[model samples]
Target: MEKAWWKESVIYQIYPRSFNDSNGDGIGDLKGITQKLDYLKDLGIDVIWLSPVYKSPNDDNGYDISDYQDIMDEFGTMQDWEELLHEVHQRGMKLIMDLVVNHSSDEHAWFVESKTSKDNPYRDYYIWRPGKEGGEPNNWESVFSGSAWQYDEATDEYYLHLFSKKQPDLNWENEKLRDEVYKMMTWWLDKGIDGFRMDVINFISKVPGLPDAPNPEGKKYASGGQFFINGPRMHEFLQEMNQQVLSKYDIITVGEMPGASVDDAKLYTGHDRDELNMVFTFEHMDLDSGPNGKWDLKELNLLDLKENISKWQNGLNGVGWNSLYLNNHDQPRMVSRFGNDKEYRAESAKMLATFLHMLQGTPYVYQGEEIGMTNVRFDSIDEYKDIEILNMYNEKVIQGNEDPAKVMQSIYVKGRDNARTPFQWDDSENAGFTTGEPWIKVNPNYKEINAKQAVNDPNSIYHYYKRIIALRKEHDIMVYGDYELISPEHESIFAYTRTYGSEKLIVITNFSSEHVPFTLPENLKLTSSELLISNYNVDKNEDVSSFTLKPYEARVYIGK
Candidate 1:
């Protein structure tokens, strides 16, 4: 397999809004991020994937871009961002900004002009169509809930917004609009900034006719994903982007492509395809989502997780690359979702980290993930700050007249706010994230789970993550090795092997809390085993072939 710096990088993701607050403004900003570079450097992360900080209306927590070339007032000025970049580079770390180009803020100058007239030059910059049958052009549901089409009184037409009404979908088919996007990308690369983590990148291209989503249930709206996701002109647009902007620079590019399959990913990230370096696949993430969708929570079957992860690992093995992650700005804390966040938070967190980092791809560690931050459960929906949660509550409880308790239960489990709470720095007020009231509530367990507490303890999840990250740099097998699943049927154990040259690494992770017995596969063997890393202390003389794995116990072994 080919090797590159990005292939071996351990990326740390920072949701700028919740990381830290400077100036007592109750919001995290660029200066706050600058103050924490050393903390990240100590954790051994090579790249920082910062969530969107561009000038925005904060409709979707900065995902709605109003000015792509400028910084958000809430985040700080351009100078603050530049200084933050300089500090990160000085610490031998790289920074990658979130690129949310599937849509632009309704407040963007282009959109503002586009909505003013039907024949305006900027009208084609966004997707607009006349309403059909005195209704929406299509029966597509806004991701936030409601009709995807929004009526514009000024233009006497309707516009498509896959997300909130404030975020209008861009028309990538327009050559002039595509040029504008490429020009903006070049300006960023010229600023000496690192690459981008493109948001909803695969949703850029849409089917020729904006057709209605299949509504077998006869619902008012449904997902039109098939028409837009991995659309016909996706590869063409991406290759054009590469040739025009990305190819001119030396930087890493990763796409946040939800619902992308291995075959689609191979086309996007294939070495011969000149499109992107890697993509964040959602196959593994949807394991717990019931038929209804993300909010329709269900038990996380271990076998399902094993199958999903192994498929991506083997399918993208040498053809393409993967972006490994569990928790991010959008999902709930991973430990709380996948592991016992109460009694075994520390152990399970380390185990999950071990499993992901040992894989043959780059691993992304979300902010607060190193310290094993668990999800938060607020008392009322009023306490939540995420638009997704607010909109859902209004739709289900108010409009749809569903049971409030059931809706809140789903929110407790899957709300984006579970991951957006202020960073737990210490036990002080607001978890030391801000001197004033935080934009969102801090998790009450911050007293025990704060970074200060974790960093001081050598056995904390923080230290475990630091060790795992350093180990990745110390071993080439973790990055470029061929992967093989050890036992596909084990319900509680996820074991895999990576082979490179004469070196082989066996990674064993107990996905459950039971005291399970684990044995090597009949065909696999370890002649001379050396313990690489483990969540539990190892007895040097313990048998290598079989052992009783503790709750969420994880270990990595190196041998022939």
Candidate 2:
């Protein structure tokens, strides 16, 4: 495999709104991020994938882009962002901004002009269609809730918005619009920014003709992803994007592609495709989502996780690269979702980190994840801040499809807000995220899980992550090795091997909080092997095989 700086470096994701509030304005901003550069550097962050801080009405945080070239007033000014870039560069870290070009805020100048009249020049810049049979253009569901098409009184037409109504989808089919996007991208790259973590980038392309989605559930809104996800023009647009903007810069690009299959992922991330460095696929993350979707929560199936991850590893082995992550700004805390967050949070977190970092991919560390941040369970729906969760709650509970209490429980377990709470820096009143009232409540357990405590403790999850990251830099095999799942049928253990030349790395992870016995395959011998890292330190003279793993224990062995 070819070598690249991004493939070897660890990318850390920071949701700017919750990272820190240097101004005590109850919102994290560019200055706040700059102030914490040393903290991230100390944690061994090589690339920072910052969530959007662009101008928006805060409709869906900053995902709704109001001004592509301007910074949100709430997140400080362009000058502050420039300082942040400088600080990150000085610390030898690259900064990648969130690219949310799939949609623009309704308040954006383009959207404003588009909605003015049917013949407005900017109208074609966005997806607009006449209402069909006195209703929406199509029976498409907004990811948040309700219809995907929002009526525009002035233009007597409806605009497509896969997410919130305030976020109108851009017309990627328009050459002029595509050129504008590319131009904006180059502007950012020319401004000394690293690259982008493209937000729902795959949704940019839609199948021609307004189509109605299959309403299997017979619900009010129907998910139309089948028509748009990886549409016919996706590859053409991406390749054009690469040629026009990305290929000109030596930067890393990762696309967040929901509803993307392994085949689609291969094309999106293939080195020869000139599309993206990697893509984030959610197949593994959806292992716990029941038949009814995300809200219908179920126990995580370890076997399914093993199959999903192993499929990506083997399927994309030579065709594409992988982006390994367990938690991000949009998902629940890893420990809370997959591990015993209360009794074995630290152990399980370290175990998860070791399991993923040992793979042949670039690993991402979400802010507060290094310290084993668990999910938050607010008492009431009003305490939540995520629009998706609130919208789902209203659609399901308030509208009489499900019980409110049960839905609240689901929200506590699967809601995106679980990851959006203010970062717990210390055990201060607001978890040291801000002196003023936090935009969202901090987890009450911050006193025990803050970074200050983790840095002081050598056995903390933070140190374990730092060690794993350093090991990745030291071992090329960790980044470019061939992956083979060991004991693929193991119900509670996820074990894999990465081989590069004569060097071999065996990673074993206990997915559950139970004693699971594992015996090494007879063909594989560990007598000459050395234990590289483990959640529970392994003695140098320990036996090579046939041992019972402790709850949430993880071990990595290196050998010839």
Candidate 3:
């Protein structure tokens, strides 16, 4: 494969609404992000992937875009966004905006016009189907929990919405719609933006006829993923997109695909495929979920995680690429979900970072992740503001009469609000995130885990992230080396080697609190060993082979 800037870059994901609040209205805005550019620069982030700052109705946060070319009023004005872009460029960093073409806010002009009447010129812009057998057009379920089809009184038809009803699915089958989408993308690219992180890009080309989903359990509306996920024309649409807008510039592209298979990913991201540069696969992220999906939490089997990730690492070795991440705005804090957020928070956080950064792909650092931030456990469901959590609570507790305590527990462990908490800039009233009441509550542990304390302490997780990011730039093997798993059946220890030319990079991570002993494979020897990085301190003269690793410890050794 070829070397690309994005392939070696460390990308930081910023959830704009929760990042920093410049105005007293208590919502993080574009200017606040501009003010924090130096902070991100200090952390050694090469690229900033800003979550949707586009015009929205706050439905699904900013993922439900209202306008393709305008900025959200809560986020900031277009001038503010332009200044932020200029500042990012001036600092020698790049900015990649989120591309949310999968669906649009119901309030968007296009959607509003399309929903007026059947004869409207824009009516075909959205997927509208007639009722079948006095019920929904299809038995598809919305991702946000309801029927995927919303009835329109005016047209007497149903429109498809894979997510929230407010986010109606666009009819990609319409040539005019595709042209409009391509034009909007071209408009953004011409404005000097770097690239895009396409949201649910695979769901655009759904299966033909919008077939009914199989429901063995016979629930009202089961998942129709089989009909839409990595659908028939997914590749053709992406290739057309690449030819129309992406190939014209020297930029990066990553698709946010949930159910994409490894083989499907090979075609999407292959070097000669002329599609996306890489894809954000959800295979590794879903390991902790039970058969019931994200809400039904289960213990994360270490071996399961190892096998899932190793498959991707080796599966796309020479054919395609991967987007490495543990947490995002839609996921709970990784430290709380994967590592110990209590006793060895800092150590385990660093260990997680070292574990992910050592992989052979571009690593994403969600906002507040560099400082060891944790999940929030509010007193009650009323305290939460996320739509997904609130809906689940309503259906399970208020509506279905389920135990409120159990639902709250699930929210604490798997809720998206845990990651949406305001950034802990300091120990101040709102974690120094806003002067006014925040749109959402700040994490209560801010006094201990805020960035101010982390920056002041030399051994904090923030500085550790900076060091690991710098190390990636200093070593080519970290980015492009061949990955090989060691002791694949190991339960608690994640050990792997990345070999580039003659140098080998050995990484060992302990995911548990118990001390674990590690030994090099018989075929490998550290005759010219160098300790590159570790979460635990070690004497330079201490022998590394067959040594016991402390709780939440991670270390990297390079050998010739």
Candidate 4:
């Protein structure tokens, strides 16, 4: 297998709208990111993946891009973006911009022209079908709730919007549209940007005939993913993209691919595959969801989590690479979701970080995750801003047969907004995210858990992350070693080992609040084992004989 730079690098995901506000406009901008380059560098990040900052209508909070080549007015100008890219490269770091070509905002020029006249040449740039009888063309459901088909009275046709109605899916079957997309991607690569994080790139291709999916509940709406995700011509499109644009530049590309199986992942990222370097799979991320993709608020079993991770690790061992992550803009905080957020927040956050970073793949740290930030709670659904959450609240709480308060509680605990809140920089007003009112409310726990306080405390999650990243760079095994799950049968603890050459690292993490005694694996000698890192303050020479692990404690030991 070829050695890819991104394979051995740690990528940090930055949600631009919440990272930092430089112009006092209640929104983060490019300049703010430039100012924070030193912070990222100090944290030992090798690649920075900035979420969508392109021209948008904010319908899906920048995901509904209106222009691919231009920067959004709120983020900054094109000049600012160029300067930021230069700064990142100068600091020995790479920049990966979000490539959201699956759909475009309804305000985009192509969509505007497509909706103008039925005979327009650009009409084929988007999916358009005549209404069925007196209703929508199909019973497909938008990811944001409601019908995926939006009726255009002018043309008497309905357009497909897998997400919000304001965002319409692009017609990839058109060769002209594909060329345009490739041209735009090459333009960005020509500008010296490191690479791209393809947004729902697999959803760009759709099954032919636009067939109506079987409605399990006889409801008018359900995810149309079955008809679109990883469509028939997905590989062909990706291979063409790689040959025309990506192959020209030695840049990293990670696709946001959902509903992709292990075999499908091999097709997209295998050594023989030229489609992508890696892909973000949602198998582990969707553990808490119900059978119908709705919130169920169930507790995650540690053994099940380990099994899930082990399957991906072992399945992709020799075939493809994995993009490991605990939290992103679309998911809640890891500390609050996977780890204990109330009593042992700091310890559990660091433990979770240790577990993820030591995995045998590229690791992504979402902004504010290093400092143990958590979910946000609001009094009403009116306080929420995410389109998915708002739509779910309306469907399940306002219109369906579910309790509004219970639905709101699920939203508070598992909604994407929990991770979208402004970065908590200090204990000051608005968590020091902006001088003006923030676009979203800051987490109330910011007063006790902010960057300002963590930076000065040696026992903070922020410093722990810095140390682990430093360790990864110091030891080559941490980056390219093979992973092996050791204590898979443990109920409340997860243990794994990473080995490369003569170096071996054993990582043990307690996933519960109750202290548990664990016996060392058989034949594992401790005389030569050196304690590398621990969430708790333990001396290097501390005896391990019958040692009992405290709640949420994690330790990494290095040996022959």
Top candidate on lDDT is 3
Query: Residue 32 deviation, candidate 3, in Å?
Result: 0.5
Ranking of all candidate structures by their lDDT, best first? 3, 1, 2, 4
Residues 1-560, model 2: lDDT tens digits: 88899999999999999999999889998999998899889888899998999999999999998999999998999999999999899999999999998999999999899888888899899999999899999999988978998888877888999999999999999999999999999999999999999999999999999689998778777889998888889999999999999999999999999989899999999989889999999998889989989888898888898888889999999889999999999999998998889889999999999988988788999999999999998999999988999889888888867888899989889899999999999887898999898999899999888988999999999999989988988999899999998898889999988989998888899998899999988877854788889999677777867788999999988998
lDDT of each: 0.92, 0.91, 0.93, 0.89
- lDDT of model 4 at position 271: 80
lDDT per residue (tens digit) for residues 162-212 in model 1: 999999999999999999999999998898878999999999999988998
Cα error, residue 283 of model 3, in Å, equals: 1.0
Give the C-alpha miss distance for residue 101 in model 4, angstroms: 0.8
Alpha-carbon deviation at 458 in model 4, angstroms: 1.6
Candidate 4's displacement at residue 140, Å, is 1.2
Q: Which stretches of candidate 4 lie over 4 Å from their true place?
A: 542-546
Model 1 TM: 0.99
Error of 1 at 334 (Å): 0.4
What is candidate 4's lDDT per residue for 57-172, written digit by digit as tens?
A: 89999999998989999999999999999999999999999999989999999999999999999999999999886888788888787899999999989999998999999999
